[model samples]
Target: METARSQQQTAPGAFLAFARFALCGGGVGIASSFAITALAAWMPWSLANAAITVVSTLLATELHARFTFGAGGRATRSQHAQSAGSAAAAYAVTCLAMLLLHQLVATPGAVLEQIVYLSASALAGVARFAVLRLVVFARNHAQTQKPQNPQQPPRRHAVAGAAQGGLISRSESVEVTLAS
Candidate 1:
């Protein structure tokens, strides 16, 4: 039942979903890059980048959980928890990959190193979108098939003893006048 047309109409199925994640990720990346660069100025570059990755991943997970997938009512505390877990794993992977790439290429210059780190982080962002969209915020498609009950008002009953009163007792059977 998921046609291309339907998919196009849905926010998740649209490319904007990825773009939305990317935009939020970009803000996280900027904060990360600034932190990394500042730390690198005083300490080892690798350590700085690693620290930034850890911190930024946490921030990005919460932002994405609140903003990106929230349109479909998929933003829940459990989803944020899952995103945080995934971001932690992804952070480690991203840091290791960037560090390895930098060591292998022998690029110690700040600018070049940052460029490489950003590229690696960009790849990690793609992985994040995949995991978050497919696993974390994924809605159950099967639940939509069940029949739904229409809204109805509750029934009122008249009590024998309360015939003069406005209220009726629950223990007694009462005549309920039908309203036109």
Candidate 2:
């Protein structure tokens, strides 16, 4: 029999999960792009993008968990902390990848930098979804119980009427019946 979890691990669910992540990230990306573009007028593009990504990631995580994943309740501190840590790690990866792309494809007076950054960030969002689904979201700490180990055995005890001397003289054998 297939369990719910097993079913959810299938390709359809994986696609759905990726779609959800993309939608969430798309919403965040739009906001972040706007902010970064505005800020880039006065600051370096990388710095502006970095700041916007952080803010956008926080917003995206919250909205994604609630709307996409059907998460309930006000996020607990631990949950927020976990998401924040995940977002930071994901953001760092995204920024680094974007920077690499910028260095590779960039030229003076070219407007392709932002496009490259967006693509790289989208790829990073895909990576982030994979990690979050497999690592963070899959682990339901509250519901799952750890399996018991099977290798440990109980201590042996002497059977009743077992003689330590092991002497077998003529003796009457009695048959005992057990009732179920």
lDDT (0 to 1) per candidate: 0.64, 0.59
Clashing pairs in 1: none
lDDT by residue (60-125, candidate 2, tens digit) is: 767656654444324445556676676677667656866676677655333465676577677777
Candidate 2 off by > 4 Å: 1-12, 101-110, 141-180
Residue-wise lDDT of candidate 1 within 97-141, one digit each (tens)?
Answer: 766877688756777767776777788778878888888765432
Candidate 1's TM-score: 0.61
RMSD (Å) of each candidate, 1 decimal: 12.5, 15.6
The candidate 1 region of ten consecutive residues with least summed lDDT is: 141-150
